[model samples]
Target: MRSRSSNRFSRPSAQRGVALVIALVLLVLMTLLGLTSMRGVALEERMTGNTYDRSLSFQAAESALREAEALVEANRPTPAALAACVNGICGSPNPADLERWLDPAFPSPPNPGGWQAATQVSNGPISLTPQYIVEYLGDTFPCQPGNPASTNDCKRYRITARSAPGGDRSVVMLQSVFATD
Candidate 1:
């Protein structure tokens, strides 16, 4: 009969370190996977933050636009003043190509520069104070049949609002052509 020691089951001496090498390789691979996942999460978070900042800027700009419309509706500017759009608000248009608001290179002044700034807004996290400009389009007679006396007049105004968080990285520009009462 064969001795039990002669038939013993055991790994070869040459392969003794194979299990240890496999475990180390697996550890490295798992570490790499963890690092890649962390990077992806970080990138996603940055993108989300940018989106939120942009949204805040847009909201502020919208508020400025509404305030401008109120001024037009109230007819705050006199007929003479409307004829002479002073500051950024123009009663009479100078020239289409000369419009500063249409140009991106123009240097906008601080709050109340032209369009009134919105109030009650928290400039937190993202700080973008909004400002606006009003352009008065010429007056048009509403259905002038014959006598100009009986015809009503319609005034047109172009309001543009620029909203930027304090950083002004995400500047939001909005424009609307509003006909006044």
Candidate 2:
């Protein structure tokens, strides 16, 4: 009897650390799970913020594109009217000529100092910045007689507008087409 009792007591004593080890392992696993969850939440927040920024940037770019299109359409109805559209001389109706319309010094109407325009010239050899460019797409020739033969001279004009959102310094480009009537 005495031997049995002593054996039982010794067994319990040896097993004392077993429960502690199991508990420690469980605690470490729980901590890792908690940390993982926290990281996931942080990443989600970042993605949401980035998505919002991109959405706003896209809207701004679209707005810029619309503004540019209006200018092009105004000039299109009558080439002679182009002169009145500008402060003075009509200049050229080509892409390079459009750059003059995007002066940063000129404030956009309805929202003073909210938006500024810059033109980049990208044509053969001239390398001038245009606020917008006019181009014809898909083999449609310009209805006007005696114009150069190219994809651009057709009845369609491609206007591109660029703007930086929230002062982030990242530029977004938006393009739209207006018909030359």
User: TM-score winner among the candidates?
Assistant: 1
Error (Å) of candidate 2 at residue 101 is 16
Off by over 4 Å in 2: 1-15, 77-140, 143-155, 165-170
Model 1, 1-181: lDDT tens digits are: 8756743576656757888999999999999999999999999999998898788778888888888888788864534433533445666555645675665554465523344455434556545568777877756735354766756776777888878434436878889988754
Candidate 2 lDDT by residue in tens digits, 47-79 = 897776565555556665666666655765322
Residue pairs in collision within model 2: 119-129, 120-129, 120-130, 121-128, 121-129, 121-130, 135-158
Quality of model 1 by C-alpha lDDT: 0.69
Write down the lDDT of every candidate, Cα atoms only. Answer: 0.69, 0.50
RMSD of each: 4.5, 10.7
Q: In candidate 1, residue 31 scores what lDDT?
A: 100
Q: How far is 119's C-alpha from truth in model 1 (Å)?
A: 2.8
The TM-score values for the models, in the order shown, are 0.73, 0.53
lDDT of 1 at 66: 87
